[model samples]
Target: MKRISRREVLKTTSHFFVGAIAGAGLNSVLQGCADTSSDQSAIDDIMKKTEMADIKNIKLTVLYDNVLYKKEMATYWGFSCAVQGLDKNILFDTGMYENTLMSNMLKLGIDPSKIDELVISHDHPDHVGGAMMFLENSSDINVSLVKSFGSSFKKEVKERGLNLREIDQPCLITKNSFSTGEMKNFTKNEHALVIRTNKGSIIITGCAHPGVVEIVEQTKKITNEDVLLVMGGFHIMNDLGTKTKKIVHRLKDLGVNFIAPSHCTGGEAIEIFSKAYGPKFINSGVGRIITANDFI
Candidate 1:
């Protein structure tokens, strides 16, 4: 095995979105011969059978982000969140800079060694920057990411003796959580985390390249539950005018009760979401914590 630089990793991953578009087309061709409905039915049955503990509270701490809620915390062009109070302590994505991510995590008292699983939303450098650092600290953790992740990235995980699970379709990540699977549009391949609670389901995304509304719909299809909250990067920074507003309406129509847009979601888009969601719109940034009870 050979060591690869972060720059090389970034270079390789830069091709993912374009490749994903091509791959998605091929997948459609292949699925044309298969019974997609049966597959979906099986997934629904599995989702129904998945048992979750009666979670009274779920805590999500923003470990890395482009925005800062606490002045002492570091902010960067990336995203990461620490999810606790569930079946497993999951670390979602790793912000772009290793030192910054570790510093923020340390300031927040979040130990990477305690993470039961690491769910990466994609292979972008910002989303995966601290992955190697986290892997160095934790020995017994499972890593989940889209199956379309670059080979160099996968090789790094294998070389580090990390347990890696490649996700292609909606699958149960834990007793109470399911990944919305790999969703691709024109930009990148990403997956949103879906956690089912007594109140409803929560969707956590990283740079929603497939459209946030589509991600929510996919989660709904798998969990068959109303979305209690939809948080994370919406990737709508460049969308001017009525586009962002239409997306907000689409999410509302899909039964999304709350919104917390961060990172690449842009200031304008966040403002739009803030006005639309009103009190339900959470101010998310580094060190921001949201619990399950907050939704209720």
Candidate 2:
């Protein structure tokens, strides 16, 4: 494939937004048709289901994290991962630095122009800082963020003519894949990912401010499947070892099969989880690449 330069992407950006608006108009018309008849709704449902691929065929790559899994990749105080081998190449969160994110992508052979969609867990700088710069001239314009994001951030996205998807409830992001929605609680309102697999369900979070265990339990309700693996930052950097141990026990009690905690999960928490889950603890960090083969 021909690599599209940043200049070329900017030149074509206007056309892309126009096409998106036209497509939205088309979808609105179709939505009315499907709403008026049960058969149309059923057919739409089948089409959506057909787009889904089995989890065993999926690959998850940690593109950006505070820890380094590959010696050549740089690490920053943020999180970003790529979910590929599905209907769309989903880019989850953008790390703290633009150069680091792009350079790492180049090293990993991830073409920016090929990303089909972007999912932002929350509005934190670590999670969204690089994205702001990455989106400045990129071809990928579709972004899904929680509804609670600040007006300035939303305005910036709209001003750039990007397709802003403000999700307030748990919804199907792709076939057989879901967003745990905006986890409304004590911490920053966040959204975690839930992908239903043949084996069970996989949950991916950015910071998991509401609690990783809570997010996993939420996935059970969202996808109606047993928890398979949970990855990403747990945001328990300040938790005491005793507290972390109890949290680990609770996660096991909830039937969590595997874990790959990193970033803000803290050393104490990571150690507790590592000891508890044993071999099931998959090390997570920048440059960590996980595929269906790791689980199934």
Candidate 3:
């Protein structure tokens, strides 16, 4: 796997838009929709249609990440997961690069065209990197994202003719699944997904810029259910000494039964969480799968 710096990633992403506009003859259409801002009022009007009914089992497959679990899976600096056994198949985040995302999906036997819902945690390239590529393959699904994303990004979704649901408050994606809404930290805005199972709720995050503990607490507030598993990037890689440890303890205190950190979660933090959670810690890397029965 090749290592890519954030600067290089952003540069390449900019070039992608340029190439897409010219090659797809979308310059005029893109420009025409550029000023069309997302209608927050309309998005707010959309309500949850179906609820998950006491699902005893749910499966989450890590499709893309910075860590590799299978020998053949490509590792990259991003996160994407497939949530199954819900009312609909949900895709959480689209990894950093187009080829890597598509290749990993292919290897995992996942067809992007079959995904019913796309939930973007934030606007970062690592999380939304494969948006255009995946959208090209499938526009038959609804896209749920934070309102804080760039206007141009929202415009692109609208222009592509996909249903866009802009969220700012905690809401049910389906009856048994929920979003933590848009949580603001000093630097970024993010939302974490919560899936209800007979055992407990599974909270899935992307980078967790707003703080993993904070997101977990918000999920608890919404569902009033204990979190059986807390997975995905915790974003505390640079936390020097006791900071990450404190966060780990806090999560344990909050009744998180399992911890499976990956991507931006540093190695040292994972070790701390592993020790703290003991057998409850599951290795979360690209190609890793966690089923609800594992928790029960």
Best by lDDT: 1
RMSD (Cα, Å) for all candidates, in order, is: 6.5, 7.2, 5.9
Q: lDDT of all the models against the reference?
A: 0.77, 0.73, 0.76
Q: Tell me the lDDT of model 1 at 83.
A: 87
TM-score of each: 0.87, 0.81, 0.84
lDDT of 2 at 295: 73
* Residue-wise C-alpha lDDT for candidate 1, range 78-144, written one tens digit per residue: 9999988887889999888778988988999998778898999987878987786765565567788
Query: In model 2, which range of ten residues has the least summed lDDT?
Result: 24-33
| lDDT for residue 9 in candidate 2, whole number 0-100 | 27
lDDT for 82 in candidate 1 is 91
Q: What does the lDDT come to for candidate 1?
A: 0.77
Candidates by TM-score, descending order? 1, 3, 2
Per-residue lDDT over 229-273 for candidate 3, one digit per residue giving the tens place of the 0 to 100 score: 899999988877498888988898999998899989988888888
Worst 10 residues of 1 by lDDT: 24-33
| Ranking of models by lDDT | 1, 3, 2
